[model samples]
Target: MSRNAEHDHSLVMGLDFGTDSVRALVVDAATGEELAGEVAYYRRWSAGMYCDPAENRFRQHPLDYIEGMEAAVRGALAKLPPGAAARVVGIGVDTTGSTPAPVDVHGRPLALLPEFSENPNAMFILWKDHTAVEEAGEINHAARHWGGTDFTKYVGGVYSSEWFWAKILHVLRHDEDVRSAAFSWVEQCDWIPALLTGTEDPRRIKRSRCAAGHKAMWHEDWGGLPPEEFLVHIDPLLQGLPGRLYTATYTADKPAGRLTPAWAERLGLPPGIPVAVGAVDAHVGAVGGGITPGVLVKIMGTSTCDIMVVPKEKIGTKLISGICGQVDGSVIPGLIGLEAGQSAYGDVYAWFKELLSWPLKALLPESSLVNRETGEKLRRELEDDLLRRLSEEAAWIPAGSTGLLALDWLNGRRTPYADQTLKGAVVGLTLGSTAPKVFRALVEATAFGSKAINEHLMKEGLEIREVIALGGIARKNDFVMQVLADVLDMPIKVAAADQACALGAAMFGAVAAGLYPKVEEAQKKMGRGFSQAYTPDPEKAATYQNLYKDYLNLGKMLEAAWSSAGEATPLR
Candidate 1:
């Protein structure tokens, strides 16, 4: 119950490798006070890098992660109090998951090799990538009818193209060079900690239970990954690759290893500091936001990741249907971490913003309203403040006033049956609809998507005790949170920390450094309190209840059409 005296002046650093950027945070391990933080965006990634969104082929070069992490660390260290770096004793990392890349025997991502540097197939297959849609379909078909252990059981009811095996298979089938060369695959979360700890050897990399169970179909019940026979049946190329993969996985509470001398020198940190095993960003974000049993925390950013922890005994033998998998020790040690998400949330709003401003960009190239020369700055101002102004206007319109509804699936569905081929739709649109109406409908669509995920969890008998929300959107957008509260008919608490994921990583860092016994103990000392609470309006909740049924009908209609066209419908 007492703080560590030796660590009283010490700090633990947390690095969060997100989709667009890597963020660093320096926190006092004893007092839980944040000292400094930094964010370094992937420079090449921002400029469209090696990605082709049009093809659903999103890839990130290894150097982006490497440079960004170091830059973020340097940026954070530079802002800290003089001599603070010497006080830093441990490091923790978290990143977007299912983002696995093929690596050589030496543990180098193939994309970093000179010959494969530009090959998309050799790069990290991002979680949002849908290039493996067909491959995922093949996996689902094999799992359902193959008469072996259903690998998809633990990973929701469906395997997603956005996950490990499907992405790997897609690359293997399409790129002969990569197929012949890749010795093994490594998830980004696993690779980063291993990279820092000075071991990339596939044999020695400590895989994360969070990443492997949720995305890679790894379960202790199956002994490890799916049997080699089952994998070979799906594709002969998979022979022996399972052996190359790990059987044991560790939770973030444990130390992955000591920081290597090379990385310590590169990052200007002390050598031999313990590095905690990595996890997906949102799982750690849950810890940062104080996710306990029955408390659900939503990391609402470009996309939404809902994280919850429950007693392992309570979750016994109940494979919650159609969710991003649940894993023991995924969030905190001795508990089960449950994950679910919408692939598009703020992205739906971003899509609406782009849709409304398309003609301005496409048709008004030289107009005084848009040009830099103009004092009015109408176009530039609009581009910057569109969402804010629209949010204000959208707030005025009553729930369901748009007579329109949208499916929040611009990036395809990610949860409650993880189908990537499912597309978005705006139904009931009429000539009377304006930009504000359309925008509000899009926002409502995301809220509705969240409700569906909640419903799925509830159907599996998991009670919704308390709802906590965090991340960029949750903290910034009051209107969205209120709308979400109405849709779910639940009061929502939003975390105050601007960088909750980084704080969570620091909690792990503290525990790994022996500052605390477990993640829960560290969280009690380091947790960021809620900044705001949104209570659902009775009238709005009543209105949304009816609208939700309509939304469900629309989804069924679209999904039926998609299924009839030979694509699989989401599992119930």
Candidate 2:
């Protein structure tokens, strides 16, 4: 535990590729003390304009990821001491998963070619982009009809638009160029490493067990991926997709390959430094937050992902429905990793802010007059005032006070029911309702959503002994966390680290660099965090119970209406 620079021997870099930016963290491999970090925001572009609202399609140039990664790494390296660069032993990357990008035989992005540069099909299809709903529905129907035990058991009963194969099929059927040029439809989590090593071998592309199990429907008992027949039944073009899928999917700590000479030279790292395979941002965040088995780790951001690790023996037969996936060794070895989530959280907050019609000019001056002198001081004062007022108003309203309940489907449902066609709704809102009241109800609605998933997990025989919350929203917003605690009737433990995802990535880097023998060991040594647990208030809990009952009834009522109208029927 020497703090002196002369005694520092081990260092690693963790790179996180998020939705809007790439972040790099340089850390002490042995101590997990963050030494330096940097962030590079993706440059927004409207140059091609291929994202059609009518079609629900969204795409991004692959070059954005490349440029963003380089910038982030270079910027972070600049922050480190001159000698620290050479001491960096390994690199690890974590990214939002199931974001598929089409590439050629040489591992070159098809979108980089001039002819396909403007084509949406050639670019990366983000996980949130739900344009493939139709394709996903078809896959689900076909899987059900086939009744394959292997396929149904592994994927928790349905394929989703937020996965690799579904997105690939959608593009292939709609764009002839994509079908012809897509030598491989790769996941972003895997592709980043492939790009770094300059290798396109399907064998060489190391898939994270986390992504493959949760998103791509890979499992151990079935070996890897669904049988070839299942793929053919879904789409003729997918006949050989299984073979193209990675054979030796690895854990987050496993080294995929050494950095290529070009990447090493460009990033100021050793050429042969080991690079761990990519992982889901949320899963890595769990490791970073110091969560062990039976502790549900909620990575709350624009979206929220709930991750838990459990002994294989504890996976009882409550039908464990609604969970995204339960893959063995996906997070920690000798345990089953469970993933469940809500598609929206902080994004809903952003939406509410956007809906506020007041101009900044009008609000800023009044906000400053109320408390501050300088512009920065005024802005901080205003934000504090607004958040405090909102929280107070929200707290005053009883759990069922608004007499309104909402479905947290602003981004679509991800767990317990993986329905993308589902839309958000707020029922029992009257003309007398105010914006703060509505906003409070919306917050409660998300809490209810989390409760639903928790119940599903309980039913599946996994006893959630504890709840650990991590991410900006969890740490910054006390009101939301308290609401969640009341709704779940369980104490919520918030992680101390501001950058849980980055810290988790660094832990993986430590293992890859051989500073630690395994991921669990690295996690124990490197993960540093204090937990803030919120005990449920009996009065609030009682109120939420009644409100939750009403919410369930309303949900059923809405479903019946949709069924009666035949709106729930398949489009095709």
Candidate 3:
């Protein structure tokens, strides 16, 4: 067979570790064909262990990740043709991030140790966890007043509780056992690649540029992380912590190392296959969707991650304010990746569903209308169909027909200034307000939140030439997309691939394995063009324009109220 024919048959695997599950996708590197995919939910996470929604603490055990990855990879391989597994030459990984875990000197998560088995602080602190709000506030204050370099300049000028340093400080200050045992910390993206490559020493593990630059205050300007003197000023507990962590970071296109024999055997893949460096899910998804200059890719799932890449020369010395971060090579090599997002998106709708279903959960099994089994089945059916039914009904209510207005801050705002202390609100509620009308208002509120981020980006001189959407909500929900298009007054394109993030990882994997010379070549060969487009309706756009002004005014009012009540200081 010719070299071109051999290239056409090569395969790669993309592993995506999400909030609730892990997804593995097997792809043809030459054709972009998705051979097979499997999703495995984390058993412990599904059982609701080690998380407290009331306290805003969400942690995941390393065992869940290990087990789920094995199951997903093996399951995906089993669905392929006989002997197809041997064709796999590379693996790429992406995970929800700024999700950092405490690790011992050997680069093992603390949760794996017998002594810290049950401690939440020992597990991976999930990105949605907001227990570190006070710590984040202190960091933000110190970054501005410390008389040294402003470390938070590139990260939207505000550090978030949902990020790396704040979470580590929160855990260290609260848990003495974990603090003593932890020799270093690792982001979920960095940890997975390190585990696969058998890089056990904390200092030797390859850190992800995507994770380190975006969440860890790592920049080329300051020689990596903030200086030790500045950290000690934030808190004495953070003293000397910087010395144990990494200084160098690599982009996803580079190979972290070859997959170890143990990991390869467990996943039914060959030993010594190149493993591409890991990255946050949104950045990977952007690559899968064919992101380019002036284009924005929004990964909309439970929350939303908006990603855009600009040339390094174009973004020189311009710090975009009120975003997540702008990091070099965080997405594509030689480009600066800019991220911004909401802490809650579909989650806002889920909250309403849970609230409305309280009576069904509380009374279904006890009712005389049915037996326990039948009641349980009925409850499940109702809950599963609730969003679909709401969307159908909500679609009929024209914009501004409902006077209700809401704030999509139930989990607190993530971008346009990161503040977790702010709570969601619903105003203009009356006896005549039906469930669907209120739901429409909620959907509009989320769209308004997105527009805020876009406006902020454009305000800082980044042009959004086009908008692309991906993830579960983007694929499944039509009402939300149409409303979003109307609110932003821009047409939105939905990526065709169901698992764009996983597919993106595979593209990077192909590059790492030398199947392609660069990411652009891989993307051109493997990219799945958009499936559909949502065009803005001019009349509806006009209506949303007026409604958007109302949203901003109400948001300002709420911020003032919070500040006056001493609940929190407005960061912006």
Candidate 4:
């Protein structure tokens, strides 16, 4: 048989619920060949429903997930060959972490009910949302003083606004309707699988080990989540919530349950097919990118999620500080998955792009130079090509040539101490500075942020042997990749698969379906190798080393200024 013919085999579907959209990827189970995929953007989210950028509040209705999933699956299936849908043996799911929603006793999101349908507090609190900053700070303080188990220890000794408990607490305290109606909270990652498998009871939902351990402070050492005593101490509003939530969590490789007949019919798939327990996208993406011991797999997209695995025996009893979390079996079974990242990466570029497009946004619709429709089309054309054009020009400028310096904290810092209250800064701007120069500084700032994460890991005694890159920014942006290599002084390889997170989900799906004995075996067979490699330039690396010190110094100065003035308050 030809290579194409040989690729035909039993298929698995990987559904990735990203911030803006859901992606459905179909892959050959035996060979890891990517056959078809489709992307479905959430209509409500695209139109800016239930989000306030100024307030740092981002929410997504459960209907968006349901619609995106069904649409993406059906669209992807349409692109596959004959009988391909019938050959699908398993399905896997991944979603953004810490994206939890208030749910009723029946395990349905509160936003799904008529009364709470339009309430932003009832929707899924997006992972990037920072509305819970005060709540996170309160939890952090109480964990240290409550005279109980320190639930924040495993999660870098700090609770973040962008996590499970803090978001729920924020909603409960602020919104009376949601507070009274919410019987339990469910992470988007865990809830999706439960939705597919027809699990109605919140207690029966198979919680994700990745989501629980990393964000919700679930630990076997602590028996489960932080005790009721500790929670009530933090806030009396949290009383009895733990018992209503969950006591156990399952890894992504395990099956949550078989797909229910109703969902199977809706998705055009076989009933009783295994549905792997859901996990955060970055953990699953790390697996898809072939992450191994000491390999730092960076999922660089809207934000950056840095993932590395260490053997349980090697990392036993040692907690790494100033990261997202280190969870056992979060990425791969029987290993310790360590996650750290920036709260903003590509979003920084997008922010700059939006800033530059203000003239068009302000002037275009009212222009007499063209028809309104024509003006809109031209405006979009320029906006869409803005980043690519900026990157091309920026690449020509030598390192540190532009005197401008930037801090990659537009969406707050996620690692080396997670601080959502910190705002982004751009300093040392001169009259000679151009758009491209400012853009270059922003790109370099993001790269510097990544290096800080790597250095922090090494400082904490976790060795980084190699760096693997995946996600949209990694695959599509060579200029950014080269800058990252120079900043980190390490070679980076991009994963071959375009939809690596989805592909990783499919690997777990294969294991859940009993096609592979373990996740490692599935990865060995299905993993697509690296497509491109970026090597650090010695001259550029030396220049960046000096610039990095300046970056750190500036950060400290700004932090001190904010601390003294008490100006770094969270957006309300």
Q: Write the per-residue lDDT of candidate 1 for residues 1-572, one digit (tens) a residue.
A: 53482447879999999889999999988766788999999988989988987898889999999999999999999998788899898999999988999999989999999999999889998888889988888888888888977888887868888899999998998899998889999999999999999886898999998998899888889888899888887898888899888999999988999999999988989999999999999999999998989888899988999988889888888888688888888888899888899988887888788888886676676565545455345656778899999999999998878889888878888877877878898888789998888889988989999999898888889998999998999988888889999999999998877799999999998898888888878888787688889999999999999999888888888887764214354535
Of candidates 3 and 2, the better by lDDT: 3
Candidate 3 has its poorest 10 consecutive residues by lDDT at 563-572
Clashing pairs in 4: none
Give the top-scoring candidate (TM-score): 3
lDDT of each: 0.88, 0.78, 0.92, 0.92
User: For each candidate, what TM-score against the reference?
Assistant: 0.96, 0.90, 0.98, 0.97
lDDT of 4 by residue, 134-239 (tens): 8988888888788877898898887889999999899989999899999999999989999999998999999999999999999999898888999999899999
lDDT of 2 by residue, 1-572 (tens): 21332255778888888877889998887777888888887774334355664455767778778888888888988988786799888888899877888877777778989999978889888777888888788777776676675374555675678887789888888899788887777788888887787767655588888888888888766778877888898889887767766766889888878899999998888888888888889888888888787788899987888899887766744334556788877777677888888888887766666555344435665663554356456555555466557767888877777877887777767876676766668877789888788888888988988888888777767778988899888888888889999999999888876677888988887777677777887777677766587889989899998888777776666555542212222211
Global local distance difference test of model 1: 0.88
Model 2 Cα RMSD, Å?
Answer: 4.7
Candidate 2: list runs displaced more than 4 Å: 1-8, 45-55, 316-319, 357-389, 563-572
Q: How far is each candidate from the true structure, as Cα RMSD in Å?
A: 2.0, 4.7, 1.8, 3.1
| C-alpha RMSD of candidate 4 | 3.1
lDDT of 2 at 473: 80
lDDT of 4 at 123: 96
